[model samples]
Target: MLPNRSLSRKLKIQSLCSNHKQQSSLCASFSASFSSSSRCRGYDDTIPNLKIGKHTRVIFQGFTGKQATANAKESLEWGTNIVGGVKPGATGEHLGLPVLPSVRSAMEQLKPDATGIYVAAHQATAAIEEAIEAEVPLIVAVAEHLPLHDMMRIHSILSTQSKSRLVGANAPGIISAIGKCRIGFQPLPTFSPGHIGIVAKSGTLSYETVGSLTRAGLGQSLCIGMGGDVIAGTNFVDALKVFETDEDTEAIIIVGELGGTAEEEAAEWITEYKRRTKNPKPIAAVIGGFQAAPGRVMGHAGAWTGLGEGTSESKYRALENAGVTMVDHPAKFGSVMKDILAKSGSNFKKMEQSLAQQRRSFHSSSSPLRPQASRSTPLNTRQQRSLHLSVEQNATILKNYNINTSPEPDQLPKSTHFVGITVARSARSPCIIAAPTANPHQLPHRVRRYPFDYRSGPSQSAIKSALQHLQLDSAPVSSKAAIVKLINSLWTMYKEKEAITATVSLALSSENDDLIIYDSDLLFDDAAFKSCKRQQDIHSLRNLTLLAPTDLEAEAAGIMYIPLETPASLKKDGKEPRNLIGTLVNGAGLAMNTNDVLTLRLLKNPQSAYPPTTSANFLDTGGKATASTISTSFKLLLSDPRVSVVFVNIFGGLTLCDMIAEGIILAFKEVGVDKPVVVRLRGTNEEAGRRVLEQAKLPIRAFDEFEEAVREVGRLASGVEAKTGVTEEGDLDEVLV
Candidate 1:
């Protein structure tokens, strides 16, 4: 909103979305003074365990409160030194924890070493003040919405005069599970006691990371959620320091995203930590919202930007250059860490066996992460970019235009015909996977198969006949192809997929469904919203296979529910690992059927808003034909484990090559990375994308090729690739190159 473009406007805080709404910028105000030569990263590692004060205790100021009570009880269950609570009038009474009228009283009696402040944002100032007065050396503020100025002032006071450590204003707190103490609301069930440490921005991502690590049979020395707000109290470097000191913590996972220089700062600290620490722990990372445009903010209130390092792609790349290994998907991050730790010299199978048990228990109908409350957000712009980026070291530099960040991206015709196929028999499915003959709708078709609360098989003839009734059963028969083309011009396939995913994600929040993506009460359910969300996650194609429209005119069809088996099926002897590693990411495909090459030109970069290298990909894919091209591209892309991601950007233009089904399989077989390959094949030749993938015997994850891929890609990438090893400087500059 500023008149002078160069004169940046200070960002203001916006309310966190209670429901699925368009995301706003992540920028906000904060006061910071960085000493360019300062090496704060090593400082955490050097804080010897014996050097700190003793008798650590926690004071949940809002102890009797809802979240506070739950977290407090859980903390107590985990052996946290919850000394007491403070209620203005009820001074000398006790509930679960002891009751103290004031911190002064608690301080005089307990003489605690560390304190965690669990109070509302409005009360944070007073709580912090009390902690300071009592001289608590460590403070983790577990609340959101503390005004920027208040945080600035509080931080200033805490940093200058106090010995206390202010961890967060909106954080989920920390856990040293094995040490028999914790400070926040980490579901005790998911946290097994072990050696890995975590530092993350989003709570969901943190939980998922823990889940992944647990699945890999690893336990956490401490899994910390720094929170997603911009002004979190603790930085990545701070958490790393804790990991460095914990004897149980053998390695660390530093989760980051685009927007803010925390990762870069952490990178700088790594150099110093390497020099200072005799035994350095391995680190890994996973960053999200890579599709976000430069200058576009995503999460956190205090996570403001000054130029570079504030984007997802850049942050992850920076972490990688810092020598972290890529976990690829959020669900697999622990594996990456395990591998690094093994390389760094540790018990790999012990971790793997533990993980096997965890995975075995995945989706035990009783677990929380079910799809019942599991939201269906459309593919976001960030996810979309993650799909298409050929080599994304800096995800923020992704092709923004490729993503479908809209709730209304899905706009199907009031009465439209689609080109679909009726599958008679197959090793996998007995049902049908129909797609738009011409991909005019630019939508994706996804069928989620969770370990628990899965869908029963829908009738088949009912589905096959639905397509036949519309005279759309056969492929390539486009009656209103022109009209479809026109409609596509007005909307992108990715956007349409987003709309559908959003609509369904919101609509299917049936109270009966126990799908719980987050432990908190954040669920999105709205028909229109779901449609829009679905549209974004997809490009252009409906999973006519699963959506059996019950038209009386349609015949009865039978489907055999596909099992959600782990890839590379493991044996009793444990020699074979799981195969078919499929994940959901921002939907965008790799090299197009049209453009053969897309060079980042890292050496001779352009200074234009539309970089020539990237622009060429768009121009080429928007053009023309071929059958083998689709599969060949996938094969080429999948060959490199580093090129683990495969994106399908479906505009109504060139990428609509006549047959892409085969491409999905070739990439799976040839690429052999077994990583995630997000597909968004829309526009002209979308049917081809579907037909080929459906034909292969390989177990590949095929969805409606639309924006659904984009949003899904984000979810898939949210928790993996935690920071690892050491990092090298200067590779981040290669994004523009």
Candidate 2:
């Protein structure tokens, strides 16, 4: 059920009015007008056909493999128009489909419109190149651990060609629910054919949102999982462009998370789009990681916010400034869209009834979401770690590259002014930010910035012009020369070292009028480690002490882990003790959502014994996790003394539930289960996974429902008995800003 209409109206009015503070009265008038008449026309007949449809012929690379065969079977069952498949060094048939020797051979014989690459990470580049050379229109790469250098090379190759549009190197691929076409491993039951279009960076989060929408009588027309890797083949803007002209898509939902400037770029495009289009579709966005700590990498490799522009707050403000409705959480997507449609006077009852019936029928079917073994093994974890250089190391590298560096901290004189130099991941070149402060961490209110080309370096005239505009009282000729040389040297070092981000803080000496580096931190590109010998040499200088012991263990075990509680948070000086629930989940997005939901629920129930509750750590046993990795993850979580209970949430796609269950059982036998375990398993091989756990009779409670599992975990953590009823659908209402 939807929230109260009055409350929804109040929230909508507040959001619309907040943006136009100067003209509140005018905004209110416009808001009233918008509610009554800004209805999105259901589907434009004139719009061209979508990129993927029912009649689109599809094929598979690595066709004879176990993963591809399983996925092909599911796609066929879901009514995907799969014509044939390609498997090098193999002939004949698999799954009643022809398996040719190569992509070109399949192209000549079958003329497939799309191809799904289920190949290993190391082989992904070659498979994609072959598909591109054959001019396949749509290519989906499902490998999660593709090396950064390989992706960079693929991007370069893609830029030179205009034929193929790659979906993901780490993506779940695309699914057209209305068309009954599935190219990737999306859970089929959660999707329904409707007028709403969905695009997101996280696959599991998309599934969760789609489930809510489906239950609320809303179905999606098209859904695209854009993958959460740092450098993806398709971005938010690319997906938005398709939705902009898509006739079947009446409304759009964007699920953006912290990381890159994709959300900012999408906001800029939407601003321009609204200016030109007469009737722009309403857009509601849910940006994840609102409570995420700074400098901490979330579940996704690309989810860390290193730059100010990549922060969740920054992305939200940008999207809101572009007039996009901001949803606080994914659970609210259905309600927000329903309200939007209601205001537009779109009839919701008939469509809702139809979708509800479709969902019921789909659920009643005997088809089970089963797990399939993947042909590819996990990639070496060493290549995934990014090398961070300390102050002394950064200074040495700068000097080695002929760049100027400040003297030691003890030898430096009193500072007059401070300047910050940084090259963000998305930045074209280095930027010099000037602020009036000694603290390097504080972001100044008003700072003058000089952005120059890294290739050309900083020019003397440009530096002088920028200095004259500085907010400081005076800029002497000597100070200007010192700043120029400093900027030039930093730019040279940044370019030569292949650094992803080079943050330098420098102080201007009052006596000598020279700029001396006070603190320096550098992070080099992971791709460079594999290709550049200099980077390999510099890799030896990495500060191993910076990483926690658990972090190093998780890396060795080939799983991602992050401790949620700091040492201070765990130290309950005089306050009520907090209980830590250790979590194990697959996929980066699901890991974040699990942590978020657990935190929110715990915060709401303050009367419980655990007044301040949190997770012990954030762990993601990658998409292709094996039973061994799962066992290792359990060992790591149990090793943390602060952890009170364990919660395992698995949404099987590439990672199978049966495999996860087997891993849990293995951990019980190998390490001895000491803590109470709560497991919520769903998707491929869910029934078998649950049966395995039940048969084992281990000290674990397995649940098929998400809310039930969460409730159980909370009950165990708080030492309180189980609750009877679940919260009403609309009761957990978050403010939609």
Candidate 3:
């Protein structure tokens, strides 16, 4: 019978790829070659029933652990061929199935088909490697809090191997209802063997969506939790590839969040899928946290510092532009996705599920904390009691968590595709709807504060108005410490809107020409302008002498953010790099000195948001700084008509002064590029690189004297020093601090 398992699997594979199949031509009959499998034909509106078969064998990577035990019991109850368990002390003992210490032993004995990983964050790598050694086709790792570097290493590992499939380091396992089975942590009762292929980044959000669909009489073809980490094993594109082949999956819904360029990448893939395939699955998606600001560290750690990829605004824009419909928040996932599916001409009926089904699916009477009865494994009476207690405890905890708890089926509104309950925000008007709510239950359909088409203000005029608002119209603002304080006060008192504000022409154009990006993520809005005036005294945390600041002058000029760290004077070396001249900075970006506070009180304050000459703005070059990047960045500031000079503060982490010197030499080669760049070089390779610059006759003051260098950048930027007529622009447009 066990050998028959392998034969059955082979036959099934042949049937799917056979020259003449009786049923739907998923890929075999309609395709010319096996190479055509990549085409993912017959993907629209078909939900393949998940086949639970004997050929499917799984290995639990984290056996004998509490969470692992729960999932293991569920897997066994679901009739999975769970042949081996990788438990520490329990190795060599039988836990119903053989408990092996390592994956090799299990593979030698049972030859499992897939792996369900439930390892600790730190142990994730070893567990995955063991699975690879065992030759498991698909590996789903459900370990959270793995470091970014480790995840990247894992990603590197997966990229090289062709047969090995990796799911996540911080994700729930994937469950294919219509095919073979593997689940990470989804509530099994909530899922039905249906037509939609669901892929999501969030575990809790995925659960909510699954429950909603099940209640709406719609089951899933498969539900995969793609992990909400910086780098997951599988991306949306990979999952979509699988759904494309499955005859059961008629539609594909992807759930993503702000942070990481993952969603944007997914958007490009979806667009290609549409253009290439005849009957592409209509994609519905939910983009989470559109209401939240970037750099705020909202949900997942990956969602926090997306390395400039996962901004909510950028992700939303990219997804929509690619023609993949998406929602604003995660809550309104079902409704928006249903709308998209309906539009795609899928005759999706909102058949209501029975109350008994809902109760069973939600495990309402069974108790969510309790694991279902398992015949494959045995448990002690105390362990059984602990499981029951843990269920109740967890249930109680989740109920109080302000989480979107499982709602009663009948109480759920008769909305399309089992959209989540629209909780009333306030007693006033109903919550406004976010446009483009199209992702499967993973995307939220909330009220968008600003309309996507809210291009009411003229783009150019807005820039001009913004410049004028900063008082950069005629002359640079004065550097009176008290007067600077007042302007800063005016900035602090203004109320700022909580939406993403746009920017201008030469605003970091080299990086992204599509939008002429702002210098950084921080940009104050009109509301911030209003709120600044109401404040009595703007707390002067630190005064910064910004050299050639084009972006910060208009954006931060007079507003405030909380937990604001004091700024430090950046010179050349040892200490962290702060603004020595016309550079922009965020709090965590720059290094600080113990004396930054003293300097903030002593410095001559500048009028606009730009810091005063006595204090330097702490704009760390955001890692390595080459000369062209500096020059381009400087020019970006210079184009703003507010910049008078540019100051370059580089600690030279991998970026040596010689390369910067070459970049400066390159800049000088180009006419009309004459910003005085004050060079601060520190660290290894500085001396040789400096000599190269001196030999090249690049007009750079390579300095070992850190403080002296700052003084120079400061003096020129202060506008009190003798004006160098080196600039061809007639008058100084920008000054780097």
Candidate 4:
């Protein structure tokens, strides 16, 4: 084992020698013997390992490009085996090397094992596909700004191919200090031969790591950038596997950033590797973006974090919890790795020897790229028959496997289903209008109603007895008090011969027969009414004074179900409310937020001449609302004489924007909306959904930002011009703020 104090001194000496004029000759000598001896002898057919070395021939796609020319020249200067290049056309020779027209042509000439892509964003995907078709063992993709869907396709193509391994779309690529090979743009002098293997997401971070390691006298055996894209060709786990088998890689240092689960996943593999090998090589990690603001894109495409997503703090905790040495600073990575190497050096060397010995006799004629067969071969008939006999002889087998071959079927729990109640508005003002849901899976019978009438002044004993009979005896004390209070209040009103249109949302708990009161109103509060409109628990208990109760009407609108024929009697106000602004949203929070915005806009711009009652938004279609349901909601809003304009504000999460867009289109077709509708759609599939609305040729104006949508709606309703229209995407800070 190396001593920590002495190692730092040795590192200083080596650093001096590496910078000397004769360092190139010294590096060449190390390279000649390093690549062969360091080539992993512990190759397992089961493990996906791409052992790259100095001898590996490399080809360049888009060799004619300026970026490619510069990088390729640097690679050649660093002793990289650059065989040929592919430029499609106008490429005879470049930099004393033959430049071919295609990957296939270049492959025939050079038989390249690896390729680097440095093409324009438009042609990057095609270049990668060409390299894959030619079956280049390793591909280091350095092209940036490739479309997200195109990158997904590239990953798919690589996944299907067994023999190939991909590095990056926006990566620095891989380097072997000992092998004297540089595939990507890594500062060669910063690297020194030692024992650390680095697998990182960011190219700049990897460079910083190499510098740190070199300074610490713990130079890398292999350094691979797994790309900064969300979906890279290769991941941290793949690179770790290669390092795990390499004899030269005594320890590993993973450089990760925020905004991906790659670091967390690597921690899981590190834990598993420790358990399987019993003596794993030490691993240290540095997770970048610790101080980065959430949802702010930090240089790379995949470096932005969201709520409960790949944050640096979360990733650090994950690795630390898995026993990995988590380095907070880039400069500390080398020192941390040096400390680990000092204590674990001898054990790592022994593990290397053991791994090599273990794989010496593991041979199969099948291709290494193909999955290895299971160790257990097919069982004989006798063995199978013995197992069948055991199953017949014992019930333990079924219990052990939780296999229910003949177990009793699970019984659905008993539930109370309240039947529809009749309310007399003349003397008996309010009553519950709920009937048992006639669902097939529901209990057979409905809950029987109480016979004690409040109008007749039933005895206290009868009232208490009725409560017991209805199973309200086991209800919560507060609920019982509420019921008693409601009954007394109703009895007082019944005596006075006064009527009120009471709206109450009912939720029944079958376990205790307790009714959960969500919301109640003597007079309708439009904001509260809209908020509870789509709640599954809400049952509008209206007084059915002069008509027979119906099941379909009761189920469709709950207690608030206004019949088409009973419009005159059901109208609470003698005249319709003027200049009503209706809102359509997918969630209660969004509904509330949009309502708040409208209220503020009206209060702030009193002179803009908005109606006093226009503050209350009339509609909220909760998260579960489908296109058909949303259409129905819009129709009802437009049907109202009070409503002049509708503002549809949807911040979609679980619900998609496309689905909402389709609903808006359906509503326009069904209701023929003539009113000015200001629509704002954000979140999942926003662009596609916006296109759906735009193509429909509807008069609805769509805004990308919430403030703009609200401002436009307010301006239209108040008969004024909208201020400024900003379509910039809202960030996490806005949501939080």
Tell me the lDDT of model 2 at 284. Answer: 84
Write the residue-wise lDDT of candidate 2 on 182-224 in tens digits: 8888888677888788888888778767876886678888888
Off by over 4 Å in 4: 1-49, 306-308, 346-737
Winning model by lDDT: 2
- The C-alpha TM-scores of every prediction are 0.45, 0.74, 0.43, 0.43
Q: Model 2: which ten-residue window has the lowest total lDDT?
A: 373-382
Q: For each candidate, what is the lDDT?
A: 0.41, 0.67, 0.44, 0.53
Q: Candidate 1 deviates by what RMSD? A: 24.2
Q: Write the per-residue lDDT of candidate 4 for residues 641-721, one digit (tens) a residue.
A: 666778887655435689999999998888788889988775556678999999999898897645455556666665544
Error of 4 at 417 (Å): 25
- Whole-model alpha-carbon lDDT for candidate 2: 0.67
Instruction: Give the Å shift of residue 262 in candidate 2.
Output: 2.6
> What's the number of clashes in each of the models?
154, 1, 74, 1
Best by TM-score: 2
